[model samples]
Target: MPSADPSTQPLKSAEELAQSRRRFPGESPQYRAARNALLKEEIELRRHIERVAAQRRALPPGGEIPEDYRFESESGPATLSQMFGEHDTLVTYNWMFGPKRQRSCPMCTSFLSALDGEMADILQRVAFAVIARSPVERLTAFKRERGWRHLRLYSSGGNTFNRDYADEDPDSGDNAGFNVFVRSNGIVRHFWGDEMGPETADPGQDPRGAPDAMPLWTVLDMTPGGRGTDWYPKLEYGAQSKTGT
Candidate 1:
């Protein structure tokens, strides 16, 4: 059954809405009012986060991308220069699927799904592609299973591409990341990535990726927890929402 949206529901009568001495699990005269104040704080916090994300996008894309950086693509391999075409900047998402991992990564899967659907608008300007450290064939198969249709996918497992660029550690088994690259004066440079936590984002101050780009905060904000704990977004099917995935 479809869930009923509270926004569309009819309001309760004043008498019906009135609570007894114990409205919640415990009896408290101030609990309801206290919760109401917290709701306002949350709304303000969200607005602040939005403000920070805007700052990050507006800060300017920096760093010089080299010309010789090899990025594998669906049509085989191509250098960073070739990927940019007439456009000077290129953004590559480091997808987390490798030969050793049996299943496609959940977070990367979700991120790619969102990018695939939204590529048409960005394609008119920025060059965006998903790059994996895994072999092209392996990455292709993984994408097929996920039914990813729009965005281009590639593999750069052959060389030090992932290591020199995206920070993939073959020995550590920690995989998948996203990095934005820009080319200027025939040099390709790395600008932004999603791996670093507090230092990179300053979640309390600078919400770099912000609400839409990341899955954790987007999903968390809907719940009562509101990104309260330190839980990481897991690799699970259906976690990639339709708005994004």
Candidate 2:
């Protein structure tokens, strides 16, 4: 593998790169047909996903948005609903990217560093933020060190937000995750998290119901492996777990 230049980027995902290579230089009937078939399949899958999401949105209203989930920020306090900005929804990524003592989560960092460059469009549609129990100052410092400028971050350090979100459980020794918050009937209810049940490397890993960290995967798909076996994220402080080597 070659060293990537921090300043220069092609912004292509592993899959995209693979696709580009798979294309034929000369017009071969078989190649063209294969490509078209793949394209059609992908389009169908995407449409199916969209339709499912539409159904989820169309589900009958459930509960009311809680007005009292107060969070203290650098500027001041904000309600859970206010975290979405002026939009109707918000996505928060529970990042382990904290101080040097803690370093960063390799998996989370890989996903996050990918987020540094293009977020304007996503923000325009839905509010997004990376929330960590660590201080905002720590979060900002780490982001600067990593050169990730496009992501929006907030401090949940001073509050019970982490506990409430299920990202951290003092009893379980849990770490992190991604969650989605939706406001309905003036109450904020958490609609999604990693509870879908997928076996993974980390003792605890939840598929984020949010969309903030996806752009990087989209870009990385342009690469050859397209996020394969060789790729794995780690914690910067040390590769081993806190409780074990």
Against the true structure, whose TM-score is highest? 2
Q: Lowest-scoring 10 consecutive residues by lDDT in candidate 1?
A: 13-22
* Count of steric clashes across candidates, in order: 9, 23
Each candidate structure's TM-score, on Cα atoms with residue i matched to residue i, is 0.64, 0.65
**Per-residue CA lDDT of candidate 2, range 1-245, in tens?**
98889536654443453343455568787877677667766665665677667776676654453444665454566666778778877877777644333566676777777655557777888788777666777777877887886787777655666776754654444356766677666667766655432444344443443232466566656687665555355434464457321
Compare the candidates by lDDT and give the number of the best one. Answer: 1
Could you tell me how far off, in angstroms, the CA of residue 41 lies in candidate 2 after the best superposition?
1.6
TM-score for candidate 2, please give it. 0.65
What's the true lDDT of residue 113 in model 2?
A: 71
Query: Worst lDDT window (10 residues) for model 2?
Result: 204-213
Which pairs of residues collide in model 1? 64-188, 64-189, 65-187, 65-188, 65-189, 66-187, 66-188, 106-235, 114-244
Q: After best superposition, candidate 2 residue 20: deviation in angstroms?
A: 16
Off by over 4 Å in 1: 1-43, 54-62, 198-212, 215-217, 225-245
